[model samples]
Target: MKKMIALSLLLMAGMMLFARGSKESGKTVVEIWHSNSGPSGTAFDEIVDDFNSTIGEEKGIVIEAIYQGLANDVLTKVKAAASADISSLPDIAQLDATACLDMRNADYLILPESADIEISEIHPAAIEALMSDKGLLGVPFNASSLLFYYNKTLFDSLSLNPPETLDDFAAIAPLLGEKDSTGKVTRYAFAGVPATYELGAFIGAQKGLSYIVDEKNGHMGTPSKVLFEEDGTFRNFLGHWKALYDTGFVNNITSGISTEFAAGRTATMLASSSSLTAVINTVGGRFEVGTAFVPMTDEEATGGVNIGGGAFFLFDSSDAVKTVIEYFVSQDVQMKWAEDTGYLAINTALYDNPEYLAFLDENPAFKVATEQMLQSNPAVTSIWLPSAYQIYYSFQSEIRAVTEDGKDIDEAVHDMATLIQRAIDEYRAQNID
Candidate 1:
């Protein structure tokens, strides 16, 4: 009997391919709230339209796609909405590490018993970070990886090449930095670390650096004194930043002087490869741009992608909701996402196809972004949550205080770490189900 039901479900899914939406018996309304807007947002809308034309409109499962600003913003609005609080929620919603955990923690999300995500289609690192520890919360959307982006016009004038390793990064700092009338660095060379990514790509490039060790354990490490294990590598990493700050080579943190970088005020920066597309599109007519993979230390940066861009999640409801999720997360829908938008296809098979890859070859800007996306480690960090953003801000504040207010590094880091740990505890208590 069980086998019969399983086979029946499979047959229904296969038959869905035949649902062309010309009949009246087909019309399942499944609401999908997401956070993609603008042109890409339009692309998402089209994907739903196609999916509807294919299966939902015919089989009664209509996929409704809604645009809800940034993920954090959506989560706030979602928390306020009464429907979201009830167990019977919309069929689908897009969430990040924190939102996924929060919803799943309260049993507000239902991991499809049959939904074995095509993990191979996705990078493993992202699975560790974005999806729930033991249960899958949502499918990937608009994910990206960090890369080394430089001022190509500046590099050409200076006759320089892009950095491939940490050593190379150190080597170029001096050449790219600018000193003001008082010998103070008015323009910095690199701008990756002082941002929200929290040097995740930098540490990930090294071998065996992860905040989480187990997929089922949705927890991040609480480093006693150091953010990383007491390995000399972390010490070396932080020590270098301290020196850079002291020397005034790196002034702004968290996307340091992006305006400066864009205006050619800064020479080099480390940011999302996805940002490359926008940057190039924004500056393509005016300046020459250069891009390379994020620099490495020991291992190639294949840890997994951090789920930078949000994805459409299937909210908890009934069997109808599950159907909606399946359709949206299907290989078919994901392909449209990659092709029509800047996001690389979450499906690995897309990478294997000569035709799809040829599209990348034709567009160098998208090609670079895709290349970096291919190198991502994973989307979620162990013990990371939206509350971690609070920690991120705290860390940023401490760094600025140390630099601008002349606070001691030891004192600042110690105080900041304590505050962050407290936030983590609070998040766990409030969010951990």
Candidate 2:
């Protein structure tokens, strides 16, 4: 009877242990809500599925992504959810730079250093953008900057080299232009990016302005009071772009810029280096595409940053949120993520990996893009919204109108400045000092 009683107790204890292990090891789903749509969405889902199961453990963390647009739209949704006090907000959220400001303000994110990530190792600019007034708020996942992507075949045929300066760009435009019988060019030399960012890049490069006024203070890089004020640098850049557009030198064809570039109907394109693969895939390998550092006015370009691509956000205040965010920034995940996604790798050590070098060598398409890492920089001044976002969108609209409608550069620029300033004042009035 004693032996039987002992055996029964042993069986119960083993069962209890097994149950505890099962509970501890059971799969924890980290729901990811994103708008990585189309091919990107598909690829992202596959990657997540692969990662979720790669450990071959039944209890591994399963990342469930809800495909939603670019990173910003997902952030908008997140904002709406948060406003509603929705606790079921995805455990992990990916938002673009504009949304990062909102996330930081709301305390909706956490420091990456507290997680498993190698936080200090990423590019300072990327980290700077993620840090709030208090501390680091998010991980710089899928980070990128604007770079000059050009067609090598076209440049070779015209006996031209890649233009490295704005003057170079202007000088080469006529030579490389494919003109019609009417002496009008069907293929233009340069293109502008949406949201006034590409123009801002040129302005910053020309003026040698540090994106932020003071690097240490964590104030937003650009002063709302400055950019939209009289004779501001922002106004000047818009005027120049408007002139280019009115003269038919700048083509702002909304329907087919990407297709035109892919078909080699345009000479060059300014886009995210991360989209290098998308462009290549769109080009269907018909010709070789080359990437160069974005052109400049100064002998050495100082500005190299883009305004989009979301940060990795932690929705929950629990230890899980911190742990997962760190994982997102960690050398293991971030390096591989950057490599796979064509964004700037967060880890500097990734550049040294022989395997990475081999991958780059084998994939000649990534040569210019990968090189931009050594030469490129990060996003210009972070803008916190209500007014900042309104200004950004409104500025894009006015700038687009100036270019699209062939409006006068100086007059249009001054008008836009006034309009944007009003928006800024309205915002400050509502959310005062």
Candidate 3:
């Protein structure tokens, strides 16, 4: 019965693909698999419609944008399509930044430079986030960085400022939080779980910009091992994090974080810049929200937050597909995308545009992520690994073990490194030549 159901779903998907590829007035049909949803999805669809009506119509090219669930789900579909029938694949795919390694290993994409598609206007950090040993792996579409979010009203009441470093966070945690007579925390100074996303920023923000894996964070070549254990990067970050944990004001919970912040139960959070809009909306004007760069490991730290979000991979190297890619990354479209979705515009030229400047002036929250990206160290690029998802969970669990289970920090870090290295070894054994 399960096999029959699976076969039925497969047949349905193939039929849908056939319907999508059916010719319409002899126009070149280009399909794009995307993971955008909610306002971002709506904004992307509008952009696609704009393209279809104007440039697409003029060039006799019709673009079909399909939302294929979240980033992981889209990647799964793309991989399955690659193994089943290459013809079933879309001309383009927008996948999370971490998927670059998988895409590179699969050799399933075409280089934009080879197709004469110019990307000089895009931001260098955004370009570097998707780059590999094979040159550019994808075109950055929706770009974001980690941000520090605080309840401005709470900070102002206590005469406190947003923390600039982990030491500052520890210093201010007790003052910002409230506790019961029994010494149990009733209001948290900070509430968040430092998973792979947050840990990447923390690790990258070391004195010289540390990397989790060698080969320049897997850009120069395939990463065979992680560097956290040898370089003491993880140890340094864990020391600071453990201090923050010892403050008794930090809540290491992941669920209802934004809710806790909005309800005034937590004073601050560390989250993706893309959550800026949603965070503000969830607060519903109850309190003012402020945004800043992710806190550095210490006052002497010189590194910056790594880029997050997704990039577009080209599968069919056609002029129409290139045009679509160019349209998405164009200054005008990028400005609109940033405004609508709270994502950083990949086009660096947008920063100098008079209208964009005015927009930033009006919306200061959206400006923080862009400023951080522009000032980030060149060494701070996205971590590309085939076992990125597994590594994320390992970071979460190991951190929990030290903070909650009273395990030794060194033991936890060692175990985490071992788990990550094992995952990497297994992936390389299965995938790499």
Candidate No. with top TM-score: 3
Go through the candidates in order and give each one's C-alpha lDDT: 0.59, 0.63, 0.86
Per-residue CA lDDT of model 3 for 1-433, tens digit only, reads 9999999999999998898777676898899999888778888999999999999999999999999999889999999999998889999999987777778877667877676788999888888887777888888899989999999988999898888889999999999899989988889989987988887788877875888888887888777888988878888888888899899988988688999999989999988887778888889999999888888887766688888899888888988988989999999999999998889998989888999999999988888888988888856887877677778777888887888788887888799888878877887788746
Runs of candidate 2 exceeding 4 Å displacement = 1-25, 56-59, 111-118, 182-184, 210-224, 228-232, 235-248, 297-301, 306-308, 317-319, 330-332, 376-379, 385-393, 397-408
User: Which 10 residues in a row give candidate 3 its minimum summed lDDT?
Assistant: 107-116
lDDT tens per residue, model 2, 1-433: 9999999999999999997875545667677787666445655676676566663244356666787666767877888888887685788788766664466466445455545455766666677656665566677777776778788888988788887766567667766667789987778776654454465466444444443223321244222453433435555556545444444556665456768888767888788767766787888878888778777744544655433455677665555455455556566665555555666665666667777777778776565565654554544544444445565566667777766775666676667666655655565575443
* Candidates arranged by TM-score, highest first: 3, 2, 1
In model 2, how large is the Cα lDDT of residue 197? 49
Candidate 3, RMSD to the unseen true structure: 5.0
For each candidate, give its TM-score against the true structure: 0.77, 0.81, 0.92
- Per-residue lDDT, model 2, residue 217, is 16
Give lDDT for model 3: 0.86
- Model 1 local distance difference test score: 0.59
Among residues 3 or more apart in sequence or in different chains, the pairs in candidate 2 whose N, CA or C atoms overlap within 3 Å are 35-69, 95-310, 96-309, 96-310, 117-326, 117-330, 212-221
